[model samples]
Target: MTTAIRRRGPDADGAWVDTDRGVALGHRRLSIIDLSPGGAQPMESADGRYVIVYNGEIYNFADLRADLEAAGQAPGWRGHSDTEVLLAALSAWGLDRTLAALNGMFAFALWDRAEGRLSLARDRMGEKPLYHGWVGQGEQRTLLFASDLAALHAHPAFRPEIDPASVSQLLRFGHVPDPASVYRGVGKLAPGTRLTLSADGGEDAFVYWDTLSEYARAAGEARFRGDAIEAVDELERLLGNAVLRQSVADVPLGSFLSGGIDSSAVTALLQHNASGPVKSFSIGFSESAYDESPHARAVAAHLGTDHQELIVTPEDALAVIPDLPGIYSEPFADSSQIPTYLVARMAREQVTVALSGDAGDELFAGYNRHVHAHRSWPRLARIPRPLRRLAGRAMTAVSPARWDAAIGPLVARKAVGVGEKMHKAAGVIASRDGDALYATLISVNPDFRELLRHPSEKDGFEGRALEIVAGLPLPDRMMAMDAIHYLPGDILTKVDRAAMAVSLETRVPMLDVDVIRFAWSLPADMKLRDGVSKWPLREMLYRHVPRQLIERPKQGFGVPIHDWLRGPLREWAEGLLFDSAASLDEYFDRPAIAALWQRHLSGAGNHQHRLWPILMFQAWRARS
Candidate 1:
């Protein structure tokens, strides 16, 4: 099983087992810190009661070590890896305090001989992954888990039953939400949680941290009393410190720069904190609409950093499509995964560790969808539900182009791409209430149930997010949901998988503990001021990078998925839906998929979001 994930850790491999105790631990080491053999795992503690096989860096290990020494809990020293520090901390502080003191990204499993139990834990913000399940039934039932699904699947006892409901969720949300993998009876561990299993077949689970509750607590403490400048100053200092902590690596380190507010700010801060020129990576395309390399290059030049870039062609992207199944090792539908993989591949050629600016959009109100939906919902809600539904039906009754030509100049302030915006609004205009409205706005296909043969019930993290963000203002509520749901499930998963596929490590400093708390305390106006998104991030970044370079409209870091589905990928897609229809026959309604594909092909509607997940699911099924 450990050999299956050799790519995640090319530096070393080890295993520890005690047949009498009925427990085993395996590790594949990436060897980022303490290159000596002393830092290797599966490690044994000084007291010999605890054993741990850990993945990911503990950024606060040095502080923890110091605290232990001060408290007279320190053991004789070993090499300086975070793994050793973690084991020692566990011995001194026990599971709960050691976990609570951690300030990093990780997922780990620890065995306790004294208690005759095993514990699994994940990091606070879900930066890393851990999947677990019972491999069998009766007295033979065995608990199994690993950092990647491929490792778990390689086990002889592994069961690979497809969960149809999760497939329906993939069609709706692009990625399956957490606590539910595509495989039945296997679950991705939730962020800020731990589960303990004992020799008697009893189970216990606990949440060590809670993102939504913590944010609410921080916000309720008090709004920031300072003005914009003070907020920006504090953000820059906190973000710079985060970069410094993550940069403590024995291997080469760099960052991904799209020249957006988030990436540019991280790059600038990293360069400031570095002793020499920081290494930066980016990827570009021929299609200018999706390219950000030119802007990234400009930022790198001004920051005086070593920059690397690749000009990706259509063939390069097409080559990655066939490998997505094996790479992700599960069904995932985010189209940006292609470009993300390309950039990570490029960066791995130069550096072993990379930093990313991912969570800024979730922490601040950076998404136009969230902002526009928040703005438009109130006015639409004032109208009666039936009238709103009627208005939505009338708006989408005609083709978007016909709508544009028919009512293009009627409004006082004509909306850009007025027809597209109107049609999007129509999807949520008739929602039953505010919560339902937000759910519809974020879904790829709000009519997802109609596509499934046995829709059954959702029973995933989707409902958890909606419940958490219940009565806050729409913009903040959406931001909280994105931070809680979309950030870990989609954005962070994309970064982690794409980077780890090639043995490179990526960190997101925007999700730092201090940064998150500060983000929550600032009023929404500070984030989305005067109709501009990420206002505080913009203010902080402008001081380092010229405002001219940083103030452009936000372009998504994604591929031209829609055009490709209709053009380059059409034949490949047909082979899955039409030729190999067995998976669809068993789980989904092939006729609905065929009608949607036909409608997209004929330009009747743009169903790219809907079709992409179906294609991804089919591709994963065919490969796995």
Candidate 2:
């Protein structure tokens, strides 16, 4: 099982078994911190009460070690890996206290020999993954857990059955939300949670840290009494500290610079604090509309960092298609996974650790939906429901191309996405409330429930963990929803799988617990004001790079998937959707998919987003 996940840790492999207790633990080491046998796993405590196999890094391990020493609980450490510090902390402070004090990304399995208990935990932001479930029935049942599903598949007792509800969810959200995996009986441990199981089959799960609770606490406290300028300055300090802590790696480290506010801010702070130039990596595309390499280059040159870039062709992305199922180990349909994988592969050539600017958007209200909810929703709401629906129908009456042509002469070429945005906004305007509006904005298939063979038990928006913040302001509620759902489920999942596929460790500084709490405490106006989303974040970023260079519209870190599906990828897509129609009939309504494909080929409208998920699922089905 450990050998199956060697790509996640190629440096070393080890196994420890306790036949007397019917327990075994295995590990694959990437050797990021302490580069000696002292850092090896499955590591045991000096007292031999605890054994743990851990993945991911602890940026504040040094601080935690100092605290342990100050508290007079420090074990005379043999080596300086975070794992040793963690094990010591666990032995001293207990699981809950150790997890609460952590400021890093990690997923670990800790076994307590003294008590015959097993504990599993994931990082607060879902940066690392932990999958656990029982296999077999009644007396034959055996519990299985691993960082990757392939490892679980390696166990003879493991049997994976596809869950139709989760497949429908994949078609809806582009990724399966946590607490539910694509396979039945297996489940992802939610972030900020710890699950403990005893030898007699007693199990309990507790949330050690939760973003929803933090959001509520921040909102209730109403802290950050300072004005906007003070907020920005404090934010800068918090982010700077986060970057510095995450920069603690014995191996070469860098940042993924997209020239956007988020990555640019992280890159600038990294260079500002590093003794020398920090290695920054980005990828370019021949599709001018989709490429951000020039902007990243400008930022890199301005920052004077060691910059490297690759101009990727369509073939480069196409080459990665066949590898997606294995790379993700499930049916994930996020098209940007191509560029994310490419950039990670590029960085792996130069560095082992890379920091990203992922959760800033979710934490700081940087998504377009946040801005639209703030600016457009009130006006749209003022119109009666019937009128709003009429307006939405009217907007969709014209094709996206015609709408683009009508507005093309007035805006810059990069703003051509405006028409598609308008099309999406029209659909959202018909929503009855903020929840419905947010749901419409994020949905890839609004009517997926109807398209599936069996009725879906839950819609994308149902059973989410974000209901805690439902009574907050529309923008805050939406941001909270995104932080709990989209940030972890889609963004973090995409980066983790893509980067790990290349044996690279990617960290997100913006998601530091302190940073997240601070971001939520600020007044809503500080996050989005006067039609500018992420205003405070932009203010902080401006202190590093010129506003003009970074002030452009937000572009997704993406490939030209729409163009690819219609052009070079047409035959491949057709083979999956049409030639293999018989295979998909078990899940999809064939006539509906065929009609959508035909409409897309005719250029009547862009159905690529709708079609891509089907292709990904079909491709994954073929492999699974």
Candidate 3:
């Protein structure tokens, strides 16, 4: 199992087993913080009761160590590694307390030999991945866990059985949510959760921390009472501390600079704190509309950092498609995964660790959906339900192309393709309520039921939708919903897998617990103000770089998948859809799939979003 995931930690590997206790632990080391052999894992404690095989870095380990020393709890450490401090802290303060004090990304397994118990835990925001489950039955049952699905596949006792419900989730959201894996029986451990198994085969799983609960607590108690300037200053201070903590590492480190609010903000802080110029990396495209390298270059020049940029052609991006299935190990249809992988690869060439400006969108109201919900939902809700339905139907009566042509001259041009935006807007108008409306807006395949051969047995969102902040405005609700769902499930997963594929560790300072709490405490207007999203974040960026260099329509990190499907990838897509149309019938409606592919090829409409998920699923299925 450990060998299967050598890509994640190519530096070193180790394993420990206790035959009498019927237990074993394994680790593949990346050797980021401490380079000596003393930093190796499955690391054991001084008293020899606890042993752990951990993944990820502890950014605040130095401060934690200082606190322990001042309190006279520090053991004569063998080396200066976060792993050693973590073990000592676990011994000193116990599991729950140690987890609460941690402010870094991690997923680990700790075994208590004296108590004959094994515990598994993930970080507060699901930045690192962990999967666990029991195999066999009764007396023969065995529990298995790993950092990635490929490792689980390597276990001799593991069985691979597709979970239809997970497939439904992939089609619905473009990625499966937590507590469910692509395979039956096995499950991805939820973020901020811990699972402990006893010698008797009994188990317990509980949340050590939760983003929803934190948001609720902050909403009820930690509401930001300061004015705009105070809020921005406080935000900058929190962000600076977060970045400084993450910047601690033994090896070379840098930040991904996309010139967007999030990445640019992280880069600015990193450079501000670094004694030398911070190393920065970005990936660009020859395709003008899809490129953001110019902005990134301007930011790097202003920040006076050592910057690296790679301009990839369509062929360079297309070359990554064949490896996506294995790299992700599940059906993830986020097209941005391509650019993320390319950028990660570029960073890997110069640095061992990189900080990203992820979670800023989720923390603050940065998604277009949040704005759409805020601007359109109130007006739509005022209309009677029947009248709204009539309007929605009328909007759909005219094809998206006709709507675009009719409104093109009257309204200003949008960043998104007019036809695609109009079609999506129709879906929003057709929603029945907030939950349905948010789901429609986020869904890549809203009519997944029509595409599948059988009804999904598992309810979407696990029988209930998110209602973290019940009484908040529509925008806040949407932002909170995404924080709990989309941010960790899709965005974090994509970055984690893509970066780890090349043995590079990516950290998100924006998701620091303090940052999350503070962002949620502010009123919705503070986040999205005067028709601009991520207002406070922009304020911070403007402090470091001029607004003109960064201000523009938000161009998401994306590849030109729509153009590729019609041009370079048409043959490959057709073979997967048409050549195997009958074979795919067991899972999909062949005729429906064929029609969608034909329409996309004929340019009737841009069906890339819908088709991408199906293609990803098929690609993964073939590899599995």
Candidate 4:
């Protein structure tokens, strides 16, 4: 694993193994802070109570170091590496308190010699990736972990198998939900949680922190902003400090310039703080509609950074898709991961750590669905049940099967689902409003009402998220659901697996726990006001970059999957849906799948929704 990272950033690599204590920690040095060997890891504390292997930048390490010194515990400074400061901080303050003080992106493993235990933790928003697995049985069992799943595959104990429910969910949501990975044996450490393992490999996982619920209960008036001026000013202050802190690397560091508000904001701030040109990288697609390189180039020129860009074709993306199972160590179907991986690979060639603008979307309610669902709520209520049903049937028939294959269907299935949501909301909200609305918005699978009949199915999957928001007021629940669901499951998972696949460490400044708590305390209207999503976040961006550059409609980072399935990927997709050599009977109804495929091939409907998950499952099966 260290070797792979070395290839990505070759400045240094350090490793230490305690055979007596049954622990091993390895680090690939990027030398972002205190570039000397003193920053080396596996880092041990002066008292030898704790040792740590960490991946990420700790923006507030200097401040944290001063705080530790003020507390009357000063270890002689070797170099100004936050890595050493972090290990000492743990020894001085212990894990729980130390974690609370951190304000950067990190996934670290700490071995406590005194306690005879090893603890693994990811940052609050999961900006870093951690994968763990135990192989063999009984006394011979062994636990292995790494920043990416590919490293885990190096162990002989790992196997490849698809989890049926995971396949269903990934296909529906474009990423696997947390606590469950695509792999059968391996599991991802949930964001803000920790796992402690004994020398014997017995392990216990626990949540040390969860910011959403905490913020929901915070006194709102403390950080409350009554208008855009206050919102923008506070955001600018919070984000500028976050960027400044995250920039505390001893080695060369850079930013990912997406030309979007988030990345642009980061780049602008980096330029302002740095004495020399800030390094920046951007990945583009051959499809003009998908390409944001032009925007990135403009932003890079505007910022005067040492900029680099790469234009990847669909063929380029296709080449990487098959390798995903190994890269992710589980089933993850986020198509954007293709570009994310490519970009990270490009960035790693020049810089060790790259900062990103990821959490702004989730924190500020930037998703279009949030807007669409909100708008449809009132309109959906006005239509009478009989009229909705009649309209749905008529709309479903208006576009014939042939027309669907050619022109795509104008089916009211989506509209009907939208209409029925009102009635469903009534039924669900009657029990609890936050729980129901959250459930309604997040369910991406086909009407699983019928699928629920099977005893083997994971029940109430939609309710799982709402359960996190059960007691919160509506505004907080909305933010909490995104934090728990979209942040870790989609955004973090996409960036971590993709970035680490190329051995580049990507940092998310916006996800600092303190920043997240402050954002969550704001009212929902601030997030989505006057039909605009992320209104507060936009105002925040304006404080740094001109608003006009990002004033256009939100163009999400996504692949043209709908078009790809019908274009270059047709044969591969068709084989999975119909002539699939693998036996899918254990998980899917083969005949039903064939029918869905025929429905698409014969122009009955667009089957990409049903097709994507199955294809991914089959691809994984073939690889395994």
Candidate 5:
């Protein structure tokens, strides 16, 4: 089981078990903060009453260590590793106090000898992955947990059923949401929550922290009493502190610089806080429309950091396509996964840990939908419902190919996927409510149920975003929903899996607790003004790098999967899509799948968003 996820921790491996008590634990070490043998696990507390196997860094371990000593409750040190610090702190402070004091990404399990109990916990922001569940029935039932699903599958008794609901959700969102894994009887532990299981077959789950309640309690009650410039200054201070804490690593470190407001701001801060020059990594494309490397290079030159970039070829990206299912260890269809893995592989050559600018959009209202909601929602709402639906249908009725043929001169091909964009806009224009509107904005296929063999009564997540930010402005509500849903299920999951596949660690200082809370407290005007977005972030980047070097129309971290499927990848895609012998054939409607493929091929529409998920699932299911 430990060997199955060796890429997650190649430095070392260890296991501890008490057969007499029917308890066992395993760990694969990715030595970052501490490299000594004393830092090895599965480690036991000094009193020999507790044992733990943990993944991820505790950025505040040193602070907690100091507090322990200050109170004269510190245990004799085993090693400098945060793993040891965690065990010691948990022993001294007990569970609740220790969990509350923690400030970093982590997923871990602690075994209590005296009580014969096992406690599982994940970080507040869902950075690290932890899964736990029972596999068998009655007396033979077995409980399993791991950072990757591949590890649990290594167990002989672990037989899981396909979850149809999970498949429907994946088709809509591109990645499976929290509390549901691809398989039945297994779950991705919710971030900031814990589960305690005992030999008596008794178990309990608790939420130690929640983003919604926390945002409400802090941002609602103590809103930042500052103007836009003042908010920017406060943001700078908070992010500066976060970078300082996250920079404390024993291994070589760097940052991902896309030259956008998010990455540039993070890279700028990383260089400012570092003792010497910082390393920066980026991925490039031959296609200028999809390229951000030049911007990254300009920013790196300005920051004076050791910069590296990889100009990836179609062949380079093609070589990685076969490994996507294994790298993700599940069915995931974020086209950007291609370039993200390429960058991580390149960065791993020089740095063990790389800081990212992810979550900036969620925290500070940087997405296009946030802008649309603020600027267009009122106008959209003024139209009668039936007329809006009629207009939307009229837009989609004209196939993308026809739209491009008719208006291609107006909207250039450089904007690639222009017709697809129009189709998506049609969906947004026709939404019935704010919740449905945001759902349509984020989803790949708003009508996903039509393709399912057994459609769900409804996908619970569509309305979930509205519930999270019930009374906030549309822009604030949209961003807040993404901070909870999209940020974790897709963006963070993609980065974590892609980086860990190469034994590299990635951190997000923008997701730092202080930064998140502060962003939420600021008024919507500070995050979005007039029609512009991420106002404070732009100001911060300008202070370190020139405005021209940083400012540009936003571009996604994406690959040309739509083009590939019609070109070099077409043969491979066909084998999976039409391979009647495949497992996905049993779940997805064949006629529907074939029609979508034909439409994409004929340029009637850009169906990559819808097809990619099905292809991913088929590829993953083949091996599973």
Candidate 6:
């Protein structure tokens, strides 16, 4: 895993093992601080009872160390890497209390020799990635884990089995939710939570902290602008300090400049603070809708940075599809992984460490889903349940306007119109009496039952869905939903696997705990206002760059998969869908899968949703 992540920092590599306890930890160092050998891992505590394998930079290690010193528990001195500081803190204060004091993006595994326990934790927003799985038993009882799925795949015990519910969720959204992996036995650690496994065969897992509600009530909009400006200023300070800290490596370091607000902000700040032009890289596409090369070029030129670009073709993306199972060690369906992987490769060609502008959207309510949900609640409340059914029926009866007729009419009616989807979405939350808000945020596959091969399959994930959703309070449910469901299951997982497959390390600055706390504390209006999403983030971006540069409609960073499967990828799609005439009963209903493909190919219904999963499943099953 460290070797795969070496592009993020090629300067050093080390592994720590406790063979006596049958455990091993590896570190792929991207030396951002304390470049000497003193910063190595698995860093040991003073008494040597605790050891850690950590990924990511901690921006506040200095202050943390000071606090420990003030308490008179001076740690054994070592190199300047945050690794040593984090280990010391874990040792002195213990896991639960120490985690409360951290302010960074991290995923770490700490082994306590004295207690004969293993603890795994991810930063609050899951800015970093961690994957784990159990193998055989009895002494060799294999339980392996890593920062990326590819490393776990290297182990002999790894077995790949498709999780049906994960497939359904992927089709509805773009990524799998936490605690569920594409491979049946492998799972991701939930963000803001910890898991401990012990030699006594006992296991414990629970949430350590969550800031959504606290941030929601922190301050009102009347004070938000001033607070926001201060927040941005502070963010600038944190980011600058983080980059400088991360830049302290023994190897070459670089940054990714997508020319989007986040990347541009990072690149600009890095250049402003650095003594020389920073090395940056970007990925472009031939397809116009997916192309951000022009904007990337503009940003690179403005920053006067050393930049390189790679314009990839559809074939370039398709070629990597086969490698998905190996890299993800699970069944992941996020299409943007293609671009993420390519960009990582481009940056790896020139430098080791690179910075990314991830998490801005989540922190600042940048997603249209959040705004749409906020706006649509009022309208949904006005419609009575009986009327909703009648209206749905009326809409369904209307003929297609020059399009295919059968399911199109049903789609036209049941579908929330682009303008009304958000409002109608409020129906999920408007009741104000239940967990409908969370249900609204996560109902993309409400009709999942329609696609299941058997009615019995619905029972599989129902308990999981209720348990996770029920555990969170109203104020935190949405963000918590994202943190647990979307962030690692999809976003972080997508970036980690894609980048690591190419030996790249992508760091998320906005996901820093401090920024997350600020995001949580801002008033709802600051997050969503005037029907505009991510209002505060918009305010922040306008400070350093012109709004005209990025004030256009949001275009998702995705491939033309829907079109391609209907076009160039049709043959491949069909072969997978129809070829398994003999042995299809164990996985999917072959007839149902074939019918969906036929419907899509015939344009009877846009069955892309139904087809994508089947195609991806077949491809993944073959490889696994």
Per-candidate TM vs. native? 0.96, 0.98, 0.97, 0.86, 0.98, 0.83
Decide which is better by lDDT, 4 or 5. 5
lDDT of each: 0.86, 0.88, 0.87, 0.70, 0.87, 0.67
Can you write out model 6's per-residue Cα lDDT over 310-410, one digit (the tens) per residue?
99999998887767666765556666777888888778778766878776666666665566456764466566767665664554344222233333355
How do all the candidates rank in terms of lDDT, highest first?
A: 2, 5, 3, 1, 4, 6
Query: Across residues 513-561, which tens digit of lDDT does each residue of candidate 2 receive?
Result: 7898899998677788888989899999999899999988788888777
Task: Give the C-alpha lDDT of model 3.
Answer: 0.87
Instruction: Tell me the spans in candidate 6 whose CA falls farther than 4 Å from its real position.
Output: 1-20, 26-37, 69-72, 137-142, 148-164, 183-185, 211-250, 393-446, 455-477, 581-584, 604-606
**Residue range 38-153, candidate 5, lDDT tens digits:** 88989999878899999998988899899988999888887788888888888887887888889999999999998999999999889999988788778778789999998998
Weakest 10 consecutive residues, lDDT, candidate 2?
459-468
* Residue-pair clashes per candidate: 0, 0, 0, 11, 0, 8
> C-alpha displacement of 523 in model 3, angstroms?
0.9
lDDT of 5: 0.87
Error of 6 at 541 (Å): 1.6
| Candidate 5 segments exceeding 4 Å error | 462-465
**Candidate number that wins on lDDT, 1 or 6:** 1
Candidate 4 lDDT, tens digit per residue, 532-551? 88777777666666666667
Which one wins on lDDT? 2
Using alpha carbons, what is the TM-score of model 6?
0.83
CA RMSD of all predictions: 2.5, 1.5, 1.7, 4.6, 1.4, 5.1
Candidate 1 vs candidate 4: the lDDT winner is 1
